[model samples]
Target: MARQGRKPKGRPVSGWVILDKPKGMGSTEAVAKIKWLYFAQKAGHAGTLDPLASGMLPIALGDATKTVPYVMDGRKVYRFTVRWGAETTTDDTEGPVTRASDERPAREAVEALLADYTGEIEQVPPQFSAIKIEGERAYDLARAGETVEIASRLVQVHRLDIVDVPDGETTVFEAECGKGTYVRSIARDMGRDLGCFGHIVDLRRIAVGAFDEEDLVTLDELEDAAQEGREPLDEAAIAAGAKARVTDFRPLDDYILDPATALCDLYEVTLSDDQAGRVRSGNPVLLRGRDAPAFCDEAFATGQGRLVAIGSIEEGSFHPKRVFGGRH
Candidate 1:
């Protein structure tokens, strides 16, 4: 069924991929690679991880992209290493040395500084960050040798624990924090508090929201699977060089989480077939008793064991906020 000489486009893939991104690869690049491998129609990521850092980067394909906002607002956990004695222009190893110090804080001194960062506190983001300054990225401005004065904003650090002090040169630690918390800022601030300039040398994200390390799939594993002919195309697609119909790529089910899992933390409301249809049509449905869970604001409606729509509650009624068509 070829129409003229138009090139073949892949099929629609709808799911979430919790990628264990390798170090030195940017988050955007990881998303692009996964999108290409899957030949997905649409894709996006929940958060941005620096090229110098690695670990859990959730890629949303097709319908799953709708739930990205909720995942981005979720808490995150990171384990990072801070190298003392010098501060870098980017607050990490990627940037050049901007300041140096012979001073090194004692283990006790570092421990005391953790408390200062915990809870809600005002902290300035690193100058070499993606934050916008007058519509231009702060990093771009800083890179151009322009003075970038980023204002301090309040961020929450739920837990800050020192995992190990590998000699007197570096400190390994873990941080559990809410949205917008930057690991590099923590390292930068800690250095200033200790009077010894410091910068993050290693960083890895372990968890984001409900997705954790256990859910991650390495890019190499996926590539290896493809090489093994795990993704078999249908006869017609193969003839057309389409490979587009290879939706049933073997082993992908193991790596790809159900699109519904993206909204697992939210409340669930299973609706009748008629109600589900109405919700899909962007109509509001009145929920009663068990269907209406107390203190539930955000929820997803399911019908026939498939995700129908994501909605919010108001006046004991569930309103279809983001309607999802087709299986997620």
Candidate 2:
């Protein structure tokens, strides 16, 4: 008898997919769906979104996964609705009602409250949150009928605007904030300040750093494309003039983005081929050009607009801190 080998796993798919997550689907679940749809070998998400919230969920596959941290540190914009007169344990409608008030702040009063929230402010996250307390999730503790204490931290809110007064019980708001700012905490604090308890009735993330709502792709679109066999995986190999191999997955080149896109916030530095080689070998390369970006803490090094490495500037030299593999 001949020896048998192990079956192959997933394909080496790489890129980013901005998903328009629907309500009731957790971020992890959305990632799993996308990963399976693409049959990718490696995948991850930039940020965590609760099941009750829906919006842009940036899924990073393959090499793009290395840049997930940059996307996570970027700014975020959220549109949410606050239901006045009642508060919930989870800070959203999913949890049981914890308190109620007859008073509802008027539109003028809500507008006045906006200024206080803008800029840096201290906020304590909700008890029903993923924040860890003694190695266990705070939500887990709360679910087990245990008290959880979350310390307050400073978070920045760049902009907060009241979009509309939906009804006597609800107020819609759009907020642009830095990383770590929680929309639920904003609603909870605003209600307390206005002498009314409140909870988030709805929440949607519209933007994350450079990625806006416009770039979102729905799950149905991906599934339908998979079913129709729009572009087979072997097409990718054929296009590259390589040997064709059999596979049952759609081509993801159109959906995936170059890893360089994630480093848009950093300045650019072009290096010679020799420098690029040095960078790829995990060594720092000298940078010199008439248009060199002013010395900064970090910059993206490239060879003819193709990413070579992400490095730092120290003492008139560019240090290749994290070099990328393969051509862009």
Candidate 2 error regions (>4 Å):
1-8, 230-251, 272-274, 326-328
Each model's lDDT comes to: 0.85, 0.84
Report, for all candidates in order, the number of backbone clashes.
0, 0
Residue pairs in candidate 1 whose N, alpha carbon or C atoms collide under 3 angstroms: none
**Runs with alpha carbons beyond 4 Å of true place in candidate 1:** 1-8, 230-248, 294-296, 326-328
lDDT of 2 by residue, 1-328 (tens): 9889866467766668899999999999999998887777778999999899999999988767888999999999999999999888888998888889999899999999999999998899899888889899998999999989899989999999999897899999999999888899999999999989899999999998779877888888776666665434476677888742324454444666667777889987778888888888988766576666447798888786677778888766788877776421
lDDT of 1 by residue, 1-328 (tens): 8769755466466778999988889888898998888777788999998888989999998888998998998999999999999999899998899899999989999998889989997889999888999999998899899988899999999999999998999999999999888889989989988999899998999999879888988988888765664456689878877643334466554567767777878888889999988898899888878547544578888888777888887887788888877333
TM-score versus the correct structure, for each prediction: 0.89, 0.88
For this target, which candidate reaches the highest lDDT against the unseen true structure?
Answer: 1
Candidate 1 versus truth, CA RMSD in Å, comes to 4.4
Candidate 2: which pairs clash? none
C-alpha RMSD for every candidate: 4.4, 5.9
Against the true structure, candidate 1 reaches a TM-score of: 0.89
Cα-lDDT of candidate 1: 0.85
Candidate 2, which ten residues in sequence have the lowest lDDT sum?
A: 243-252
